[model samples]
Target: MNVAENEIKSVMDKYRKFAVYGLSPDPTKPSHYVPLYMRDHGWEMVGTYPKPHEANGFTIYKSLTEIPKEYRKFIDVFRASEKIPEVVDEAIALGGVEVLWLQLGIHHAAAEAKAEKAGIKVVSNRCLIIEHKKWF
Candidate 1:
């Protein structure tokens, strides 16, 4: 969809529900705290973790494929950069993801391109919590 730099702010504002990939249970981790901040600010969150566990009341799906299709609108990925492509592939397979976000310090151009090619907006090297605080 080719989101322009100027349009990113608007795109980020539109997203409210997200599936957080690699979410951790540890309270100190960015993967945990960032999404917790978002949820506290009224965003709906789901977790995609290898283990089944709850995160602040959000259900943890074992995999992206396990998340309900209706809640697959946005995916906040916290995995290593090398693992982004696989996450993007799962998002694409889910068919309803509107955005694929790489947490701050994480980026994979090929995966970003792949998700963008599938009509998903790509946000790389950004913190969702920071963006929300800035824009909302």
Candidate 2:
């Protein structure tokens, strides 16, 4: 299901700090640049990388649980569609995740439902940069 534009705007407005799940160390990838774009736009971002590596000076945690609780309020995911369930599981397990945002081209209905059921707002198949530019 598509998230409404107003809900998207509200999600963006309510959560300024978020964790980037599946963040890449490569600067060329959206997993890298999207978080950078958000950071540049004044969003406080930390990230989860498979390995210990830095992305444009942002703190890269090895997993969601590694991210401090305060920064776990929102998660901007960049993993493949198939990987979303695992991400959602991790987010739910981690708790305190107010929103789960799957970036453009990423969507998983089951996972979205799971997240929403767990009291996290889900925004799927949308680009945070694009929405931010349009709404704010």
The C-alpha stretches of model 1 lying farther than 4 A from their native spots are none
lDDT of 1 by residue, 64-116 (tens): 88888656788888999998888888888878899888889999988889889
The numbered model that scores best in lDDT is: 2
lDDT of each: 0.83, 0.88
Scanning candidate 2 in windows of ten residues, the lowest lDDT window is: 1-10
| Deviation of model 2 at 102, angstroms | 0.2
What's the residue-level lDDT of 71 in candidate 2? 84
lDDT of 1: 0.83
Put down candidate 2 lDDT per residue, 1-136, tens digits, no spaces.
4467777888888888989988899999999999889888989999998898866899988888889987899889999999999998988888898888899999999999998888888888999889989999
TM-score of each: 0.91, 0.95
TM-score for candidate 1, residues paired by index: 0.91
Stretches of candidate 2 exceeding 4 Å from the true structure? none
